[model samples]
Structures are given as C-alpha cells and as structure tokens.
Target chain A: MSGTWINLLIDIIISLSLLTGTFFIFSASIGMLRFPDIYIRLHAVTKGSTLGIAGIMIGAFLFLYVEHGIVSGKLILGMIFVMVTSPISGHMISRAGYHNGVKLWDKSVRDDYAEAVKEKRKSIDN
Target chain B: MNLQIVINIIIALMWMFLSESYTFSTFLVGYLLGILLLFVLQRFIPDSFYMDRVIKVIKLIILFIKELTLSNIEIVKLVYKPKLDFEPGIFALPTELKSNWEITILANLISLTPGTLSIAVSEDNSKIYIHAIDIPDVVESINDIKETFEKAIMEVTR
Candidate 1:
C-alpha cells in the first residue's frame, strides 16, 4: 500500500518537471518570434532551452531510476553536454552578427563595445 | 590529486574483492572509508586532500544552477508580457580573470544566466562584450557579475 503511494508521488514529481520544461521551451519559441533583434533572440534560445533541457533530463532520469531501477548515464551526460554547448553556439552567432554590422534595436540604451573599439582605433592611430 | 584518487579507487576495489560483493553500495562504503583513512594520514601526504577541490567544484555547479533557474523564470515573464519594454544593448565588461579557460567558463556562465549574453572577448582578454536584454545601469550589472560568477569561479580555480 505504501509502495503505491511512493510510486504515485514519483510520477507526480516527474510530470510536474516535464510540464515545466515544456513551458520554458514554449516561452523560448515565443521570444524568438517576438524579440526585436538577433542578440535578444539568442538570449531566449540559449538560457530558456538550456534550462528546459535540464528539467526534462532530470525528470527522465528520476523516472527511469524509480520505475526500472536502471541508472542511465546518458541522460545526465546529455544534459551536461547541452548546457555547455548551447551558450557557446549562442555567443558565436551573436558575435558574428555584431561584427557584420547587424543593427541593434533602435531603442537600445547603449553600445559601450562600439565606443571601446573606436577608442582603441584612435589610440593606435596616434 | 591524481595519486589520491588512485589510492581511493584501489581501496574501494580491495574492499569489493575481500567482501565478495561487487555492488555499487559496497564500493561507495569503501570509498568513504578510504577518505577517512586519507584524512587520518594527512600529515604524511605531499598535497592537500582531493575532496576540498571536489566540494568547491560542486558548490560552483550549484550556484550556476540556481542562477539559471532564477533567470529562466525572468525570461518566461518577459516573453509573456503584453507589451515589450526592454532596452537591449552591448556593453564592455572588464574582467580580472587571466587564463583562457577561466574566462571561457565565466563567459559561458554569463550567457547561461539572465539578461546577459557574452558576445566577444577583447584582444588582450581583458574585457567581454555582453549583450543584455535590458540594462538600466551598466555599472550595477558589471558589479553583479564580478561579485557572483567571478568570485565563485576564483574560489574553485584558485
């Protein structure tokens, strides 16, 4: 009787986590469609998706461990791999866009990077 | 560090063989015993215990996950807002990290967290160009990075 209760609890936790993960991924998709520029979109894709994947992986790992008593190493490793790589790809894409003169949203508050580059060029010229 | 791990593994294996139980629980118990033995014999060891570094690394990972979850919630709120009202911009953040790997980790952590995404590192590796989804004050943002991510990383690496 107690075992059934434990199983139900585990199932509830797993479903909650899976739903949370799907919500984050859905928000990321909305941000991609709604954000004004490339850099902002990268933020949505990288952070949202990374956390989403982590949530999903944790839920899966727990489900497998509790139900089948099988410790799958791949789920944990895959989560880590995605967390490490997602930001890197996002960084690269934004960096490329910036260098190629992709315009920021017109309402952007500042661009210290551009000013820093200009200052460096002036110092070199002198 | 390497020697300590080797000793620990050997102790675990010896315990498994002697007890005729090759299960993971037995190996874990043996590993804890090995750690205790090493702690008692610390005076004879050449270097510090490996567990200190492991604990610090684990702490760093915990901090990263905490920040990731908090920021993800913030992003979800922003995405659902009826009218977008954010000031996205690129700013240069000067960093104190010297080595390439440390800087890379710092940048990756920044990108994974809320509001900020690292776009580029300057030639001398002194500054990272960060694009933020919103920036009311650049100085405050810079200090936030320095205090949280930079300090945590220095604790682990140094």
Candidate 2:
C-alpha cells in the first residue's frame, strides 16, 4: 500500500512539473509575439527561454526522482545557477541596445522612466 | 569549522545521492576524492574582497526581491490594461552609494525587475541607467527604491 502511494505522489509531482514547463513555453511564445520592438521582444525571449528550459528540466528530473533521487536535486541546482546567470548576460545585450538608441514602438506607451531622470537631477541640485 | 571539510562533506553526500547507492566503499572514496578536488581547485580561484560585506549582500538580496515582486505586478497590470500604457525610455538614476559591490547589486536589481532594465552602470559608478516602463512618478519610485532598499544596503555594507 505504501509503495503504491509513494509511486502516485511522484507521478503527480512529475505531472505538475510538466504543466509548469508547458506554461513557461506558452508564455515565451506569447511574449515573443506581443511585445513591441526588438528590445522588448528580446527581453521577453531572454526571460522566457531561461524559465522555460528550467521548467522542462525540472519536470524531467521530477519524473526520475523515484529511481534517481539525486538526479533531480542536481538539475535543480543547475537550473538555479543558470537562472541567476543568464539574465545578467541578456541585460548586457539590452543595455547595448539603449546605448545605440534603439527605437521603441509607440504602441507601447507608458514610459515613466524619462521623467524619473529629471527628478533625480533636481534632487542632486537641491 | 573547516570550510574545506564542509565543502567536501557536501560533495560526498551529493555523489552518494546522485549514484543512488549506499555502499561503504563508494562513500569513503567519494568523500576523500571530493575533499582533494576542492583543495586543489581553491588555489586556482581568486576570492573577491566583498565577501566581508555580508550585511550589504543581504540588503541587496532583499532589495532585489522587493523590486522583482513589485515590478512583476506592475508589468502584469500594464500587459492587461485596456489601453497600453508604456513609455519605455532609458533614464539614469544617479547614486551617492559608492561601493562597487552596491553598484553591481543596483544594476542587477534593475534588470531583475520586470518593467525595468538596467542598461548601464556608469563608468564612474556614480549612476545607474535603467529603462523603466510606465514609471508614473520618478522621484517617488526612486525614493521608494532608495529608502526601502538602498538605505539598507548602505547600513550594512558601507
């Protein structure tokens, strides 16, 4: 009875992890299509790609958790490491875009950051 | 506690778990070998000086989480809004915080936030240039960031 219950739990976790992976991929696809401009699209892709891959790997790991307990753990650690590092690299590219004055699509409208800069200057003057 | 030994133990345990076997011989070999590898690898790696600034590091992490959560919610709203309200522009937020470590943290926090991206950390490290989406009140946002986050970093690290 205990053996059957344990198997059921592992299977459920694996199924949930798969759902998580699918959601990430779906999000990435939507982001790639809907975001305006290369910069914003790039931003979406960067985040989406990292998260999507992590989710898929986690799902696979969970599925193998019963037979290979430690495998999932290492995969989780690797995913965390990638999650931390990949965005930094992606930002480097986005930063380059801003420096080059890449145009933003007007369809995307609320850029409050520009006024924020003026205020920062005012504070410095005071 | 010996850091080396601590690391070795972790490695050994990880190995035993990964292989999914509990043989005494396997555990003994893995434990010794991991310790040896760590000692050899430690010499090749140059340690950063900022390890001493634990408080600053902790503050940075807290700030990052706060920004991430807030920005996530903000972006979701923008995405779902009946009218698209996004004016993405590169704006520089000048900083008085001088520590290089803090500056790096600042850049990362910007990137981590959903609606904002850290574009550049000024060469002099005096300014952080970020591109914020639909920032309603700049000073308020900056103040909120500084008071709620940067101040903590300053307290601990500087």
Candidate 3:
C-alpha cells in the first residue's frame, strides 16, 4: 500500500520536472526567434536552455533514485559539464559578435566599447 | 595527484568493497561520502584551505540557482510582452578580483545571469565590459553585480 503511494508521488515529481523543463526550453525557442539582435538571442539561449537542461537532468536523477534506487554518475557529470561550458561559449560568441562590428539595437543607450575601439584605431593609424 | 582527490578515491574504493558492488552507483555514493567525510575532517586541520572554499562555492552555486530561476521568469515575461521595454547598453565595470581564474568565473557568472553578458576585459585587466539588456540605472546594475557575484566570488577565491 505504502509502496503504491510512494510510486505515485515519484511519478508526479518526474512529470512535473519534465513539464517545467519543456516549458523553459520552449520559452528559449520563442526567445531566439523573437529577440531583436544576436546578443539578446544569445542571452535567451544561455539562461533558458541551461536551466531547462538542468530541470530535465534533475527529473531523470530523481526518477532513477526513487524507482530503481540507482544514482547515475554520467548524469551528474553531464549536468556539471553543461553548467560549466554553456557560459563560456556564450561569452566567446558575444565577444566575437562585438569585435566583428555587430551593431547594437537602435534602442541601445550606451556603448563604451565603441569609444575604446575608436581610440585604438586612432593610435594604430597615427 | 592532490590529497583531496587521493582521499576521495580511497574512500570510493572502500565504498565499492563494502557494498560488494564495483558499479557506477557505488562510486557515485562513495564520491559523495568522501566529500562529506573530507568536509568534516577539514574543520579539524588548520592547514585545510579547501573546506572553506568548498562551502563558499556551494553557497555561490545556490545563489546562482536562485538568480537563474528569477531571471528565467523575467526573460519569459519580456519575451511574451507586446513591446520590449529595455534600456540596453554596454558599460565597463571595474573589478577587484585579481586572479585570472577569479575573473573568468566572475565573467561567466555575469554572462549566465539575467539580461547581462560579459563582453571583454579592459587592456589593463581591471575592468569587465558588460552588455546589459536593461539598464535603467547603470550604477545600480554595477552595484548589484559587485554586491552579489563579486563578493560571492571573492569568498571563494580569496
């Protein structure tokens, strides 16, 4: 009897986690399509998808722990790797975008890098 | 190589033997148990620099999780809104973190958080240039970074 109750509880948790994960990933997709510029789209994917993947992994881990009583080293390691690497790739992409002269949106208010780039260019031309 | 890794491996082996199962599950449990044992032991050893750093890193991880959830909701709202109301800008924030690893961690944390990206460092390596999606007040955002991530990072690095 208690076993059945525990099984039901685990089922609820797994579904909830999976649903939340899917929602976040969906939001990331919408954001990628809707955002105005490359940088903003980058932000959407970096945060939304990372958290979405985390949610999915958490659900899988919990399901395994509850049902099979087996913890997965690979899942844990994969989560750690994703968390560590996503931001790095995001940083590199944005840095490259900036250096390649991608313009900010018209609504952008300030850009200190523009002045810095001009200063460097002036020095090189002199 | 390091004492910590060596100690963890020893503990993991002990777990494998004790469980009579040299499987991945045993190793995972053993690794976690080893961490807990090391955490407890580090308190007694005066030379243990790792325990405090580990605790601070865990704290920072919690902070990042909380911030990520909040920012994810914020971005969702922004994405679905009829019109985006953002004051996007690029600003330079001077950082006190001196080490390359520390700066890298800080930059990564900023890039992972809400509506902000760490674009580059100054030539002098003293300032981090950030692209902010919404900057109603630049000083306020800078202070927010300093108070949360910079301070949390300093706790781990120093």
Each model's fraction of native contacts: 0.88, 0.28, 0.71
- Per-candidate DockQ vs. reference: 0.79, 0.25, 0.67
In each prediction, how many residue pairs overlap at the backbone (N, C-alpha, C within less than 3 A)?
Answer: 0, 8, 0
Best by DockQ: 1
Which pairs of residues clash in candidate 2, taking residues 3 or more apart in a chain or in different chains?
Answer: A109-B86, A109-B87, A110-B85, A110-B86, A110-B87, A110-B134, A111-B87, A112-B135
| Model 1 lDDT at residue A88 | 94
Clash-forming residue pairs, model 3: none
- The digit string of per-residue lDDT tens for model 3 on B60-119 reads 998877877877887787788889878888888888888889889888878767778888
After TM-score superposition, what is the CA distance of residue A76 in candidate 3 from its true location, in Å?
2.8
Residue B76 CA displacement from its true place in model 2, Å? 5.9
Per TM-score, the best of the predicted structures is: 1
In the range B55-145, model 2's lDDT, one tens digit per residue, is: 4667666666565445444444444466655665556677877888777665665566666666666656777766665555543566566
Expressed as tens digits, the lDDT of each residue in A1-126 for candidate 2 is 999999988888878867766766666567667777766665555555555566678778877767666564777788777657755886788766754667667754444344544565788899
Candidate 3 stretches with Cα past 4 Å from truth are: A64-70, A124-126, B1-50
Candidate 1 local lDDT, B17-84, one digit each (tens): 99999999999999999999998997898799889899989998988888788789988888899998
RMSD of 3: 3.7
Instruction: Say which candidate scores most in lDDT.
Output: 1
Model 3: residue B123 alpha-carbon error in angstroms: 1.7
